[model samples]
Target chain A: MIARTCILFILPLLLAGNANAHHSYAAEFDRDAPMTIEGVVTEVWFKSPHVRYYLTVTDEDGNKVTWDTRGLTPVKLVRQGWMKDTIKVGDRIKIFGHVGRTNKTIMSILDVTLADGSVLTSRSVAYDIKN
Target chain B: MRLILVALLTFSFGVHAHADESEFSGMWMLDVKIPAEPLAGLLEIEMTDDGWIAWVEGGPAPVTIEGNHIEILVDARDRQGFLFQRKLVGILENGRIDGTLTSIDVVESAAEFGEDGSSWSAEAFVKEPPSQPVQDISELSGTWVPLRGVDFRKWTMALTPAAKEWHAGYDARMDEPQKRCISPGLYSAVTWSFPFEIVAANGKVVMLYEAFNLSRRVFTDGRDDPDFFPNSSMGYSTGQLINGEFVIETTLVTQTVRDFNGEPISENASMTERYRLSDDGQRLSVVLTLDDPDNYERAPIRRRVWTRQDDAVIYPFECDPDSFFRQLFNEGRMQEYIDRTPIRP
Candidate 1:
């Protein structure tokens, strides 16, 4: 109900990119291919390694696309001051992140702006790798 | 092929061995085969006041000689922090050292870094590289982050049959441990390319690892390792200042393969790490050795360096695994997860 936006957005310039030891940011995600997937949250799996959200988005051809978006670990997300119930299934959300190299629908979500305009960030795997 | 003639820099104090022993006592440039990538390093056998001593990278290894045969053991951990050992055995023939190096897995899992018997050859270490002035042990205390590219695992190991089997069917997209909130132990805890602060007391050395907020304490007091210790990802450790370098020996490590692509960690594994600072104290270099005899044919070494970042903040990395289970279920892997995870009675 309360809107708290960009709390984990340390610095826009600094958040440009980062890579963790687990999944190489540059090797796995394409920072050059930034996209926004706006749709209803079909599913949510908030856990370690990362938190994944499956969203049902309509593409250019009006085809339904389920974007598999990821964010920082749940530990990190919780630190950003959100509960496990922050975003639930069927919630309309907008996700900004880099797309996966092999799967266009797989993404490393950077920020999630909820329907109430509150934004939370999973900028843990941000990396400044090249195009 | 990388032949560096290491002149007897500190050989004056060591007594010369017999002709047979002399054949194996010299500097050697080692080139070996592994599954990951091609790797080479300097291996040396020289005499010391106590008798014979072996050197791999810049650390001393335990060596033994019989006739023209040489056997050496050096302990090291991988970039992923799996503790293992290297056993280098060679025989002198045709004026050269030719032998097969094997890795012994201390961890219980059959790691993929095993080689049944891989071929390895070495040339005499003739001339030595210009040595830099050594920094004092006190230089080790500070916040440090890995130098770019230093933390990546370069050298590889030969996998065992079981490890190869796991790796053959492995899928990173679905099975990476971090995907389940399993933060890597020392890999992310100590060498995460993030800043970690080392604070030492008279009795022990404590390291504050930033990535997972992992803290490690290395007891310096003269005490033997516990016969019965609890299993942990971060193994128990002890350390002491040795000749201006900070050396730490760790054991009682919990077997791990969750993060290392199922690279096996034997149940009885141990690790040895030596940390040194550059002459300017601005850089720190660490040589890590993994001798997984169960999985590999030779000792694989990892060398890393870190630079000071005193002002760097140790970030937060709390891992939670509930979502991983949820993902597995959502992806129709609940049965697989349940089957793979074996619980104790």
Candidate 2:
């Protein structure tokens, strides 16, 4: 059981190390600043180069704001057991990601918690999230 | 009994000569070793009444067969979309062909480097391997995946005064062509964690990269450089096998930065690369020397390695630039990025 647990932990690191991501993450997102949002999915663009999710979140003032979050490619997500219908519209989800350097509403997705309580990691394999 | 023995001897000698001549007539899979990367491709050789003709990945080229020596010239494109020519010379022995791969960018040779090209040693096989444990460390062939742990950007250069000034003001977010879905050229392309297939046929070695679906053709045939040509990202390359190392020289490259750190490579920049495979044929090591007097005080050397993965597949990299910007615009971030970007007059 310990060997299996070690394999599970090491496998993600190995797989994440090879994440091409295509563009430089540091160029677009700020690594120092991390954010989490619980919102309802408005749209999902599952395509090549990258996959984007549009979510509607309420700010501290109770004002609703649309956030654009990016993740890995479709092929990569599919390999990770993510399907087009995995996160449907109106599904309330929680997202953990890094905020964009220029855009506050834009973020690079790191992990997601679906309405069903299942957790799915976005393609920031090289990124270490510190609690 | 003496007459029968003499007749048998004559028949045996005739069969041996025939086997030597026909050995090269078939389909061959090639694993070509480039600096830090291994390219896999296929070669098909055929004989006709006119002469010998070879097709490398369905592209036909005329060939000449002289006893154990084979020669051919093939025309193909580099990763940067430049036209280049490859001249290949091979020697058939024991059901295998081993020879040189030379290249000259038809356009760049004429416009820049007078006439001389480059060459490298390449080998061909009837069957792709891991079947037999490789004994020669110099023979590099097969699919090799990038080792992610090795950061190639750690190699630094002593920049020229002008280059240093340029680097100081560079913005990676705005200046990076790769972010715009443009080909990052040869130097940066080699550093990418993408898979590439290398094919050595008749007189040329071809590399098909999964990144942006780019391909580069290195010529091994004995041909003079052209008189004029245009500059491109990958540039024109010539390769030769020297003392068991595949040596390649590239020139007339397009002006571009070497990496995300804003390291620059001028059009006058040239590169020399040496590739060596491990004795097990599982790892390929490359030494790259960058010479750009306009950008660096002296040539900088970079080393990289790739591990052979027979099951690795090269996939299509279809990039959507519009979608990239759409997210930024939709999030109202485009204006902020533009406002913060430094403008150079």
Candidate 3:
């Protein structure tokens, strides 16, 4: 019985690891810890691996720090009706998303608000959502 | 057809005196004893007073030839409508061809790459020749359905533990970009399409992909991969006719995974494919052998067959998704989704 129980337990862990081997955001973000920030879009560097947009957030002490926020590709953005000129540097934008694992400059945006007061949400539901 | 002929007549072209069609024309089969890696299917050469017209059963549309010039059209569908274009150029006996393939009536995406991004361009050449054209081979041209995914469907690629770990890291975020409708980069696109196109000319052969306007130039021109080459998704390939088969050997790939997909094709890998057309020009067969030091434990050769389909036209593949979420996030809406909703257990 103990052997069977251990087998059942270890097998699931092995399977889960295999499942996670393909690709996941787990290594970069913690699901348990969630945070949101509103900052200005300071710089945008659109290259491969992924496109990144830098944000400048000033602490209460008035010190300015830069954060690199990740975004989708130009092709994906274009389909979402985004033109090359959609977002620009120095734009006063508010972003909402998870703080990367490092808690440094990396953030994955879930939604955004443009300087003109327009809104676009990037949140998605689980592929199989109940309720 | 008349319009095409007129265009051919007006186009500036040249060829060697022995390069005439009579000696090279007529459908020919590959004699298998040539000792080439990947052999080509039945070979057909049709020469007219003006030019030549040829096709490998399952390859791209019949190539139109005029004097020394050759032309093929590549079209795909995108947000901008049915993207169609023509690539017109000339073929030479010494294995050199200069040409420009242009997008006909397509809208350029609003994106710009500083002052450098421009339209696509490339230079091509003939790679090899067979020992002798064989007769009585009629089972080699047509659309082949690969039972597996594009990359590893045939060859078994064994990844190192470190390589496997890197794959996990990439896949996690790779899909995030793919969900946004990005190009998925180049690697993902090639393997995305299960069955690719194969075309055979006199001493040369071509592989046209339905994936990302990606085409592999195999020179049956009797040369080897150069000592130095630019890094590219598809490695440099040198081809030639061993018997009557067109065999191509490729090496020096960039070794970058197209995306998070677990394919580990190495830069040092050498791949060879053989093509042959069956009689009647309705069947195509391809035999691929992959030799990679980094990814595979042992070399393996795989085979795939395609049937002729008159209606298989290459279409534009444009991958795009929405960007409003990122824009909104930029404007500060990150907390709304994460906090309002609970993570499903």
Candidate 4:
């Protein structure tokens, strides 16, 4: 049933990714320790593998730190009411997700919340076909 | 099959069948398919007097080829650079060649062999030389756009009934990552980069996909399949020439989702693609055949021509999945989309 549901609407990239075409998250991102960092939006990347948003947050000792949060694709985010400017540069935010599996890159965002009391989950969100 | 195996042994054993003896000594491309799939970037293989040489953009190594048999130090390093290490034991008589690759080293193999052997092989032949070296078109290189839906835009021809049925499910996709710009494997990225370059030489075709800048290599040498083949997103492709068209046969693709719509391609499908260039070499026609023993009974799936769009270049499509999904969930409408969507069988 799930297959049929998505067959007609399956995007090329989704179909391709579903094909498991290349590489692996386990091969690229750390899976053991999942970290959640709260910061301010510095930049946002809505592209493949996953979406990324830069959050500039201060550590517990008040030192400013930037955490790169990676989240789901825009197709999934559309259901969450995310637009091009959902989270812009200089916006206070909190991000949560696992660390990069390869190359020890910055923290990959899993989810984020804006200073305007808005929270968004980046993992996987269903869409409303009707609306 | 046994006779072919014997030929493989002869070739690998360094018996020196011919003065021009070389594992990959010709040009290759995708020819035909139960359902046609395109021959990626460029497929070329050249064996010089010194050694067998291969070139393609995007793969691990652009220049690599070794002696007749498995030369430990020579092969080991080349294997790592080649992205796959394989051995084919077969007989080589005159210009005739037949054999199978017996080992594959891609990480995807773990799932196919289960720590054992793989059941995959490739067989190819040399073809007449091209009238002239294929000229490179600089303007004709870059990423284009998704063809409406995967099944909507036709290339040079139309899809076979089976392929049509295979694509019929695209309408049900949930507009997930694609609308958001996720790397759609290596092939989808190809179409997106219309006018992309296809480097063909020797016995291989390298598809320089400009989307996420990923490249796919389709081998055309007369090498056989490996003993242990693995399941992957793109599966494994071995190429050859039929007439002037390059035919590539791809198999062992792992089941993958096309988009958030839950559209899926079964692992059992084997695809064949034919690439033909029109006179003057302006237009490139590619026909794809999708044959899935598990999904279809008869008739291969088909897709038509992909017109060469010149002015296409590499431009980044900013796709952020997190914010996109988050905003949707916040509206409390995420469940509604899922409920209305019908599930695939």
Candidate 5:
């Protein structure tokens, strides 16, 4: 019965930090650690293995800490309707995902909320077969 | 009765013998269903300038023929890569050679010798040069999307105590070779969510995986074993058509951990896959069997089903080690990761 389950529904299981395809994904990011940050995007490196963004988040201490936020690869993200210029370098956005286990700046992006209130998901399209 | 040992041939796809009953030379296709699963093999005995040289599965073997009595001694490595002697003394009658093959390994001599040894028969098969087949494998050959649901992506591996300890100490950041851009072997290659294309032609099946931009060749022609095969992650694979499905057996793979959980598949680990197509030719299903006697109590079976996606494009998914190292350096843990590694090559 477990074999018949829709494959992409296992993203939640990944959120649990159990079955991962990436190398040491659990070692890089904790399953239980969740963080939401709102910041101004400074750079976006669309590349293989992962697409990362350099965001300057103003902490509560009023200091600027540039966070290297990681997301899905350009291949998987493209299938989920994410484009290269979707989040511009100057655009302000809110990212909700699990924070890194050791590095607080790194994040395995779950979803991103753009300045115009449009939400882009980096999750697998397995949930919807049509997508 | 002194039963002299004979050849140890492991022939599935390719590697066939052109049996010549007269001189007892050339190739012989041996079928021994006794001590093992349909033990399909090949024996090549060729005459040199003066003496005769024999080989079993590309390894040197000994063959002696006199009157109707013949004895063969082949140093065959078992599935575990352990050396063993299998003796076959057969009487060549008509064109078929009938005999009894017995495992001379000391570990299981009692059980094998007590019984009438597994019956084995070999017939002279035509050894032709490898040629392209004129068969239709289009049902299994196409660009398809992998619907890999390893229990819907949850892993519950039954590991041995030795492997359990190895997994408990698994630090993926430093332990996994994929971090260095090496292929993670066939486990993740088939289990991942990327699209892969299967092309069958010219007596071979080529699997182009989009995950690591890796291409694996499965030879169906009766070619010799890859003597100089590279010791890569996926290893050497041979395929045969069983019934209407494609059966692939892979061994000599240079992989330790099997998956995300870091469960070990030891040096003796071998994987077998049977790919079948739905009646409607839309769905391609495969049952993967992993056997590592030292790592787990039992072999694990996983199913990967796919639907034909004609227009699916396979992009380059090469993992860059520089990018990974750069990311680690950005995280300020590059040194820590280096220190944690066990100096693996």
Candidate 6:
């Protein structure tokens, strides 16, 4: 029973190793620094290589800051039933992602919660397996 | 009674041989399993006045059929614009052809057909009763997503000494073009984590990639590469069907790294790509062979498999490198990137 369980766990890791993001997520995003930003969607570019969502959030200083966050490719999002119109302009949503190592307002999105209380994961194969 | 039975057996063998020869003409779906992965392609065989003419994709080659045994030689170009040869030898039985497929890398071998090559067992299937309807050859037109269960970046490459030195000093933060929203070029573009749509029409094929919104135009109208065309990331491409596969040759690409790891491709480097759809049309496979004498000891072959996803939409990839760098500045890591980045003299 122990051997069978080990095989089940190890097999997926082996398979998921190469099935990750096209580019190196670790190089761009800081895995050590995770952040959550709740803001209104300013724009959405639901395109390939990655999907970008711009959000305007009010900071502690009462200044509106726009954060540039991106998620996995549209292909992965489509598999999860997310469409081009999933997030529209002015939609209030919460984003959880890894901040860029050099850029604070740029993030690699991991999960998103819509205003309607729907949570969607934007994790790629590599990021999903690691985190 | 024994002599009469022997005569009947001989007569039945003759009839069966004649039936198998007639059945060899038709469209066949070929499934070949290489050591790394399985490949699918379409083969069409028709009887002509000279002999059996087989159109593998759109490249036409003469096929030799003797009894139940068949032999065909296909002069195919890889993604690098190098001509390679695939020799298929199959035996027909029960409406199925089982054979050996051998690929010889001519550029590496310096011979028309390489002396030592890779061979795999291949099976060709005909549409039997109760089988799904065969997909039209033109159904290769549509959006395709990279079938990502397996990692293609792990393939070993034979880098030259100079290439090895260049790769050793690579820093992903600054050197990786994709990070700066630059086009990853053809080799990386095909296998990137995105959807690429193929539009085929009127002697032209256009591939729209979601990565950087890169688009490649392949002329099938039988025109040679222009003499004075400027080099670009995507390069010049011409395509034709050869041996049941859509073969595209790209040349005059700008000198760029083939992948994120900084494997180099010279401006003179060329790529030959073969795109084939499975019989059921559910899967599309591409075999890309790169020929760059300046960067590698041998031409490397990269195979990519994509599943048909009708609902998958290609989105515009407008990259903002300024925003990316701004984020780094916000995180206080912009200085770190500058420190690690090697300044080219």
Deviation in Å, model 6, residue B327 alpha carbon = 1.9
Off by over 4 Å in 5: A1-23, A127-131, B1-136, B148-154, B343-345
Candidate 1 lDDT at A5 equals 22
Query: Which stretches of candidate 1 lie above 4 Å from their native place?
Result: A1-48, A51-54, A60-64, A71-105, A108-131, B1-138, B165-175, B187-191, B258-260, B343-345
Give the Å error, residue B72, model 6: 34
Q: What digit string (tens of lDDT, one per residue) describes model 3 on residues B1-345? A: 999987676552323333532333544332212121222233244554434543322112235444444443322222111122223333434433334434343323311111111122222213344333434222233334322211112211234565555444444333333444433323443334234555655545566654444677666656655777885767777765446564566776655442232345556767776655555455554566657656554443344545566345443334333333453375475565345333110
Ranking by lDDT: 6, 5, 2, 1, 3, 4
Tens-place lDDT digits, model 6, residues B195-266: 788888878889998778899989988886687888888989998876567778999897777654356788
lDDT tens string, model 1, B1-345? 123223353242233325566676677876666544334566766665556666565344667776667776554444323344566688777667788878765322213254437667778766432144344444578877655333324222445566545544544444454556454555335434455788876778888875656788898887877778786767788987666667787766655542343344554666677677776788877756555556443444555667776765555655666655654565677787666554200
- Which residue segments of model 2 deviate by more than 4 Å? A1-24, A73-91, A123-131, B1-139, B327-345
**Candidate 2 docking: what grade?**
incorrect
Better of 2 and 6 by TM-score: 2
Better candidate by DockQ, 1 or 5:
5
Writing each residue's lDDT as its tens digit, candidate 5 over B219-303 gives 8886889668766677678898766777888887775676555667665788898777766777776767788778776566555
TM-score winner between 1 and 2, please give it.
Answer: 2
TM-score of the A chain in candidate 3: the value is 0.71
DockQ, per model, reads 0.06, 0.04, 0.07, 0.03, 0.09, 0.05
User: What is the CAPRI rating of model 5's predicted complex?
Assistant: incorrect
DockQ of 5: 0.09
lDDT of 2 by residue, B1-345 (tens): 999999898788667666676776777765444333233444566665544556553334446666677765554432211234556677788767777666544433112122133333334534323333434322454666665322213212456779867766666555566655677788876766565667776676777876666777677674677687577888888887766667778888887786544568888999887776667667776667778899886565555667777566666677767766776577566886577455310
Q: What is the DockQ of candidate 4?
A: 0.03
- By summed lDDT, the worst window of 10 consecutive residues in model 2 chain B runs over B109-118
The regions of model 4 sitting more than 4 angstroms off are: A1-131, B1-183, B186-195, B257-263, B298-300, B304-312, B315-320, B328-345
Lowest summed-lDDT stretch of 10 residues in model 4 chain B?
B72-81
* Winning candidate number (DockQ): 5
- What TM-score against the true chain A does chain A of each candidate get? 0.74, 0.75, 0.71, 0.64, 0.77, 0.75
Ranking by DockQ: 5, 3, 1, 6, 2, 4
Score candidate 5 by lDDT: 0.64
